[model samples]
Target: MEMLTVLLVVIPLISAPITAIIANRYVAWLITLVTCLALAGLSGVVLHHVISGEVIHYELGGWKPPWGIEYVIDSLNALVAVIVAFIALITVIYGSKSAEKEIHDSQIHLFYAAFQLVILGLLGMALTGDIFNLFVFLEISSLSSYALIAMGQKRQALVASFNYLMAGTLGATFFLLGIGFLYAASGTLNMADIALRFDQFSSMTLVITALLFILIGLALKAAVFPLHSWLPEAYTQAPTMVTVFLASTSTKVAIYVLIRTLYQVFPNTYWEEMLLPGFLLLSGCLGMLYGSYKAIRQVSIKRLLAYSSVAQLGYMVVGVGLNNEAGLIAAIVHMFNHAITKAALFMAAGLVLMRLHTTNLEKLRGAGKTMPWTTGAFALAGLSLIGVPGTAGFISKWYLVQAALEKGNYVVAGTILIASIMAIMYVWKIIETLYFEGPDKLTVHKVGSGKEIVPDLPVATFCCYVMVATCFYFGLYTDIPLEAANTAVEVLFSTGGGQ
Candidate 1:
């Protein structure tokens, strides 16, 4: 209990270099897997403690809060840490097989090591109660992600990696500048302490500027529209396994930072104002419509999914814009739902890419009959992405609608409905390419009922199935995310409680 928070950062931070020392790729992968398993277990335990109405605060170097670095676990951050670790655990398990196919044998060990660092950075960012510590971890994750993305088979990956580095560096800079402003104003780095002191400088120009800087910085990392130019290319050209991990973790952590900073460090009146709401709503609407539109026109299946992610991110932003309890819960739940669904979808993409050596929609025609399990996974995840009834996505949309109605924001509600319809269009195309399309493009034939052929990926199929099953499980048994999100909202907004 005393060491849980520090261990969350330490275990994986130490494991990365140790895993890199291994000569064998498979051995390195196993080491990384074990590391993720431990972290996942720890995250679950911490979440259990937090949900049981206990907060754990661990001070670094034997110093207490407001003077030394702190790691705090309340319902909000505990839930985020769990989601990050859970997705990372799944990615490490799922990526081991996919990495073997996508990356060079010589570089595979480094890939696994960098993968651990990325997970370490994300988990650390979520667990840290210090603003400056968050920035440090953010850099770690960003640096590791650049290396992983550069390991892609495509030459274009180098350019994508460079673009990401540039954007991420700028984002980190903005975040640091914001932190400097806050420190100047309050002379504290601890988040709880800063929150307590916010009132002292609420009317100062530096404080508002600090908030603006932080918001812009996080938006860049979160791939919010206008600043999201790096995401599509990065996702498209990165190794399939790398894409799965980044798609699941990176932006979600950025969103967590944004949520925490606003709710914990700023006054409610400032955060809930027209400027913030209007900015979020307008950007969300644009990204939702524009991203889905671009997705529909994409020839590459991976690129299609990439654009779809842009739209999915918009839904999360919209949930934040609503600024109500239901809206916040909608955003938090969607973060989990989207992370798992995107991870599964990307896993399905990896499976198809491994078999066909391509992710072109035309090249993958009729693959559903051959790799039925893999395609089934893709189809199911796609349904969740579309917010279909009884799927996790639907629950998020339902709450978003309820919030919109409660706020009397019919336009935003209608926009959400329209976005869901757009999701249907893109996802239907993926399904059609998988199933109804002919197998005229197949060059290699396998023994499957004597007619159609596909690659047998039982392990990948099983992993993907497990991901899809969670979509169904969470949809029907909504208590987990709902309860956690509601608790988070209550704690965050309760008078004097955010501190």
Candidate 2:
């Protein structure tokens, strides 16, 4: 079991270089597919073990306690690990064909290598018990993500990557500085140890400084409004596959870190005095409104979805800000729900782009008739995004509204409803384009062979079906994610067990 813990990180990291070395694209994709499947299986096993009231703790180099590096797998981290790995698995399957369409043949192997590395970093961040190790893994993922985003079509991709690099670096530096302060105050880097030692520093000003720095850094990384300038470009210009992975998992991992630092490492008494929940609530409300307003005016479909991400993240933060058990569970459930829904939507966008060679809404007239299954899948996912009942998105929104009502905050509940309406408007724009707009009548031209040649899209109706099935499956059942989220919240807020 202990060995299994390390394998989560080891398998992906080791497979990356081997995938890069393989010259044949088919072989490289095969390698990536196998590795992702293995990871998904391993993550499921770990989740099962953790949910059975077993926490897996593995110390590096046989060293234990506050000294050596450790990997901690409790119900909270294990559930998130499963989410991240599952997203990776689905994205890789979607990517196998999509990569051939968008990326050049020569770059295929490199793409897979970087893709696996990003997943490894996310898994590492989730499992590590040490704050410094978390920062290290965060950087590894951020840097690789920059490269992946830079590999897009527009010259603006370079500019987008550069901007993200600057922002991500500053965010990372702030996190490192915060870790430095914590180390200075407590002389320990392990999270559990820091929680244990935090009370000893009754008058520690550095802890407060550390708290602010870490919060700001994580907020920036998570693209929580006002610091979200870099996200639109990065998501719009990056390769579709990269956008899918980042949308589904990367920022969610950052939010997980925020949850860990605020609720797990710091004492609850500290937040009570600081009114942290109020501050979070304020920012979250602003982000939700601001992002939805911006999304309504976007001409590019991908850009619109990117803005929606900012709003969706706001929903998750609102749950955290409520500072109640129901609120926390709502936040966790939405995190998982948004990940799958966004990944499915983005995958569908990639398929459309492959056929049309563009993501501009104006150019996508009557795509529904031509690509019925793929467009239908997008519409379903879009409906989920709007929180229509009987979908995964509805489940999260239902809980969020319930939490707001529980707190007797009618204004917050109203805000959630209004924001969701805004989401419906933007989602409907794409749907309208696909179904109502008539296809342009253009002269057909044939090149190369006598066979009528159309753009070879990597994603087929089959890939779209897989994602749509997943959306409905989790949407209807609701037991697994809700249970896991409830357990995680209980573990996080239990007295004498950190915050």
Candidate 3:
């Protein structure tokens, strides 16, 4: 089991340099696909173990706890790791074909190497028990992500990557400084050990200062509202596969860090003053409104989805601010739902980009008629984005509403309703452009064979359908995500992580 945990991070890191040295796109794709699948399988085994009420802990160099690097697998992190790995599996499979359109041929293998590095970083961040070790993985993910974004064929992608690099560096610095403060206060860096020491400094000024620093830093990484200036352009200009994987996993891993820092390293009473939750609730609501409004104005399909990501992230954070078991469960559920949902949407966007060579809303007019499979996949993903019944998105919103109502926060409940309505409007725009509008809205052209030659696109279309299928399956079945989320929530609120 411990070996499985180690392999989760190792396989991707090991594959990266090998892919780089080979510089063969097909070979890199195969290596990425196989590694992602293996990771998914390993994550499944870890989830099984954690679900059975046992934690998996691995120590490095025969040292223990605060003395050495450690990886801890509990219900919470194991589930998150599973989400990241599984999404990587789906994205890599789809990217194998989609990359042929968006990425430069010379950079293809390099892109795959960076992609693997990203998976490695995310899994490491999720599994590490040491605060400093998490920071190391955070840097790994952030740096590789910059390279991946820079690989975008568009000139603007370099600017976007630079912006991301600047913002990421600021966030990492804040986090590292906070860790220093925490080490000074607790004399240890292990998460569990730090939690055990919170009581000793409950009244200390430095402890609260560290908490604020860490929270702000992670909120930046998660792209929470005002700190999210770097997100839209970054998501819009990056290559399709880069945007897909980052949207589905990177911010999510950052959120995991925030949750772990709060629930594992801080005492319950630390946040009972209503300051953190109240501010989070405010920022979350603003983010939802802001992201939705921007999304509605986007002409580019990818940019629209990028803003929608901001709003969806707001929903998850809103659950956190609710600060209860149901709230935690809603947050976890939404994280998983949004992962698959957004990935599917991006995959669909990639398919359209592959076929039409663009994602402009106007240019996509009548696309549904010619690309039924891709358009249908987009509609399904759109429905999930809107939180319609029988979709994964609905389940998370339902739990969030219930959690809000439980807290006697009717304003939040109302805000959620408004957000859903706003989401519907954006989704309606996509559908209307794809089907209801006329094809003459944009010029049509043919390249090469004049026979409509985009064979690789069909592979991504199939992958998008697979994503849409899971969105419904998880929505209707409801057992897997619910049980895992419930267990995760129980662990955070109960004595599972320790009082």
Question: Which candidate number maximizes lDDT?
Answer: 3
- lDDT by residue (164-206, candidate 2, tens digit) is 9999988998889999998999999999888877789736899
10 residues in a row with least lDDT, candidate 1: 443-452
Lowest summed lDDT window (length 10), candidate 2: 442-451
Off by over 4 Å in 3: 440-442, 445-456, 496-498
lDDT of 1 by residue, 246-290 (tens): 898789888888888878877666766527878987888888998
Q: Which segments of candidate 2 are over 4 A away from where they belong?
A: 440-459, 496-499
Clashes of each: 0, 0, 0
Clashes of 3: 0
lDDT of each: 0.85, 0.85, 0.87
Compute the lDDT for candidate 2: 0.85
TM-score of 3: 0.97
For all predicted structures, in order, the TM-scores are 0.96, 0.95, 0.97
lDDT of 1 at 456: 67
Q: Residue 280's C-alpha lDDT in candidate 3? A: 83
Q: After superposition, how far is residue 154 of candidate 2 from its true place, in Å?
A: 2.5
TM-score, candidate 1, is 0.96
